[model samples]
Target: MGEFLIDLKVNKNYIWVYFIAFYTLWCIRELWLNLYLDSIDSVPGAVTSAIIKIIIWVIPVILLVIIMEKRNPFSYLGLLYNVKNGLKWIGWASLVLLFYSILNITLLKNSIDFQLELREWLNVVLLVGITEEIVFRGFLLRKLMDSFRFWIANAITALLFVSIHFPIWFYKGQFEFPYIFSSILTVFVLGIIFGFIYKKSKSLWSVIIIHSLYNLLVSLFY
Candidate 1:
């Protein structure tokens, strides 16, 4: 029992540590980008700003991980893996995403309005799609898998993925429970799919590409 308690404590500590580090990094990135945009006369759309910020922020984080953890940023790219298998995985994931896009369009017709502009489309592809996959799938998911079982890691990361979006409700100043719930459910499903792909292929780039394409399709079709 004592050993179990110790393990639980350790797990909790790691989760909190990872969350705090990521959140701090994100906050700093946002602040810097906002300030930079303010200094400039011609600014891009919110999506463009978000993508630019993520790119600017992720570089240093990747470098830090490489230096401190002695880990390769591209380790999850799976260049050493079988090419045919990788393509198969990507194809399967893309089909799943295509189906989800159709469902999203059918269910949330109005939600499409939130991402209409070209800049917004770009943002969804970069910030929401690629950057998010890197953080959740690439960093947090990988780190969690190191300590916990696969299912546990996926569940926890999926929950965190939903929780991160809670701020949207606060920003809107409306509860909108149904909408939020649906969004969370969608994110959880996507998380599971992406997590499964990551485990199967051990390639972050594979999941990242799938994620980016999925978001692009959703943005375009929906």
Candidate 2:
């Protein structure tokens, strides 16, 4: 009986290891999808870009769910499919973010630039805001919280979030210390705020809406 119990424990550990490995790899693949989708400048229509973005984003999430189902056949789908609750959070977060944006723009005297056309704006809303939120808040943060304490998970995930923006500085040729410092600091602060929301609500939709609205306000004001 003792030997049998030890074997069962080892098997359980192996299963968890497999789950973590699979989840990480899937996340990396999703990151690659985002990079590739962002590179497609020749795409003509807003609908086309939106469709391609959805495909890239949804495929991996579906794959992850299938893997989870295989691992835990009795897993409840309700935990993952909380769209209604998510929308409620999003509604409230939107109001708060709107106010935040107005204050930042008016009080801080941030300049507004409306260079992006409607199609471009739609692409930004779908690809950059929604899809990225699903990947970061829904996938990476959730997985990290499973393995680490809440605060530690939030810190590490936030750092990763900031590091991923390194290419922006490179492309702009503004890789100065001050620019890097400020960008990281701002993202870290935003990450902490978003992480707090995620922790409190446990709903990705809330943060997704908040992030989208925040970006929209920044674009409008700055």
Candidate 3:
């Protein structure tokens, strides 16, 4: 596990430092949230978690910026750039919504209950989407890409993304093994897709939109 990261240093070993710090902080955040602050599915819980996530995810990325002082942080993160390109990617991802909708209306029509809440929508889109993508696709993915190829870096990010979710999910009793496997697969694919979008456009905005929409659509199935 550690050997893979042996040559991952750049800008005074900031990538390795950033990577380790972010995940370490994230694990602590997850443990606290899962064990002590376990209302994550509720509106208040989601909002609180998002705030904590921002604090956890943002600080390291900011440090990455400060550490690598030659580049603008937003540019370094590939964020909020080329609005037209971002919109184009969002258009491409619209199929995700269509596919999920058809699946819900067809196979899951009877079994699934669909409802939308404005608060949850805002949290998922603005808070969850912005914060997570900044950390994963924007910060970590960029750092990984600096060290490795796109697919390899994206796969690594996806695996980490999925692995992190499990402990919290298990703590929340979301661990039927089959279901867990499927969920992991789903998120891995999602991470790849999000990474691809970011790669294609060299911008994080569209990836954020796609991710938020993906979460919104998936929640409809729940």
Tens-digit lDDT track for model 2 on 45-95? 456656755665545544564664343211221234566776777788777
Q: For model 3, which pairs clash?
A: none
TM-score of candidate 2 relative to the true fold: 0.67
Model 1, runs deviating above 4 Å: 1-15, 24-48, 55-57, 76-84, 99-116, 172-175
TM-score of each: 0.70, 0.67, 0.82
lDDT of 2: 0.63
Candidate 1 worst ten-residue window by lDDT: 36-45
TM-score result, candidate 3: 0.82
- By lDDT, the better pick of 1 and 3 is 3
Q: Which pairs of residues collide in model 1?
A: none
In terms of lDDT, the best-performing candidate is 3
Ranking by lDDT: 3, 1, 2
| Model 1 per-residue lDDT at 55 | 63
Model with the higher TM-score, candidate 2 or 3: 3
Cα lDDT, all candidates = 0.67, 0.63, 0.76
Question: What order do you get sorting by TM-score, best first?
Answer: 3, 1, 2
Which is the leading candidate under TM-score? 3
